[model samples]
Target: MRVLVIGGTGFIGQHLVACLVRAGHAVHVPTRRYQKGRNLLVFPTLTLFEADVHDDAVLERLLSETDAVVNLVGVLHSKPGRPYGIEFERAHVELPRRIAAACRKIGVRRLLHVSALGADAQGPSGYQRSKAAGEEAVRAEFSTYSEGALTIFRPSVVFGREDNFMNLFARLARWLPVIPLAGAGARLQPVYVRDVAAAMANALENSQTYGKTYTVAGVSQYTLAELARLAAKWSGRPRPVLPVPHFVGYAQALLFEFLPGRPLMSRDNLDSLKVDNVSDEAMAPELGVVPTPLESVAPSYLRGGKPDRGPVH
Candidate 1:
């Protein structure tokens, strides 16, 4: 199968590309940053097109030769001035709309979209709402298809070598005497990055997965406090897990969003945590996917200290 991946140079994109290549599929990654022969290495059956995906002509041209597309573009939170449209709406909402048109014109078969667990088009957080909007657009565009044409994989917190979540906490554990937690008691079920890649491959191959939304989460749930403790234990730092009030965290996020570059946290991110970031059992087995335990994968790259092997309770 010839697969076109939008935003395929990102963390999940990189893994998804490798998986598709290994499965004997011809993969083309259309990305803006990974130019040919410039710091970016090339792979067999994995072609990288350096161009803006928002351009309809470019997207159509790329879709012409591909059998299917997987949209992996997303953002956690946006800067104050940088509206959610570019970060979330463009890739999350508009891109799918354009992709659906391109697919219909070119007679493409399938589309697998990666949406966050808490994504709700009508929800509170702009990030989640935008994601939900993206899903709705894709569904609305493809609902006419005879084949189970679109699969939406909603993953909880994803953790990997290059992930911003666990890695960021780990980095803080290494230096900070105490780690501040927002929504400290809130729970999350973090899915492994590799598993997410696997799920995408399965969705692409399986015809029964169309028009279904699957929540991909880790085997177990953990609170913000537990996550910090686990990070400290894994990093061998054992930093104190300090819980910051939600309002205080929001204030801090506001202050940080004004920083020169990407802010550590944003109000949007805080808003997202209001909903539990865990997978729903009803949707898991139907997709033929079981959540991978976080402990199983965390040790590989996150091992910096002594192991803590026991139940959280």
Candidate 2:
């Protein structure tokens, strides 16, 4: 299979690309900057195209020789708005719509879209709402095409060695004496990055996954405070977590929002944490994958051992 992967340069993307490559699929990854994809260059099956993926012409050209498309493009923070902010609309909503359109136009039928676990149309945060809108756009756009198939994957917070979730907490625990956290009681099922990558690859080959929405989660669930504590424990620097009140959490997020670059936490993030990120229905088993536990995988990387880059098989 010839797969065109948008947003294939990030943490999850790298793992997914490696899986696809190992499976002998020719993968095309487009990036605005080639230097960002240096790690992916080692894969012989991957060809990195340095271009703006949002451009219609560029996207169509990439889709021309592709058998399927994987849309992993997502944004964590955005300027606040009603339906969604401009950045969220562009990345979460507009981008999926564009990808679906491009895939249909170029005669590509299969699309595997990565959405968030807590995404809902009436969700509290702009991120969740925008993600819901993105799912809608893909479904609507592909509904008309008889040959088109859209597989949407909604995974809980994904964690691995290169992940921003556990690693961020681990780093904080290592450096800081005490951890001041928000959404301490919020529950989340942290799936391993490798499991997610495997699920995406499996969906691409398995026709049963088409036109279905799958919720990919880990074997166990944990609270935000518990996750922080686990991170600290794994990193061998267990710190006391002080869970702040909702108002105080929002205030802390507001302060971080003004900080340079991406905020450590934003009010929108707090809004997302309002909902528990656990799945009622398990999708990994359907994809022939037994979900990896966070405890089994995180300790290998966080505790200074060789990172587990093993395939789901």
- In order, the Cα lDDT scores of the candidates are 0.77, 0.89
Q: Candidate 2, residues 14-56: lDDT per residue as tens digits? A: 8899889988999999998999998788888889979898889
Query: What TM-score would each prediction reach against the true structure?
Result: 0.90, 0.97
Residue 25 lDDT, candidate 2, scale 0-100? 96
What C-alpha lDDT, on a 0 to 100 scale, does residue 146 get in candidate 2? 92
Model 1, range 7-60, lDDT digits (tens) per residue? 777777777777788788898887776653232244577777687778989888
Point out where model 1 deviates above 4 Å. Answer: 35-42, 79-86, 146-148, 282-290, 304-313
Against the correct fold, how does model 1 do in TM-score? 0.90
Q: Model 2, residue 22: what's the lDDT?
A: 87
Lowest lDDT sum, 10 consecutive residues, model 2, at: 304-313
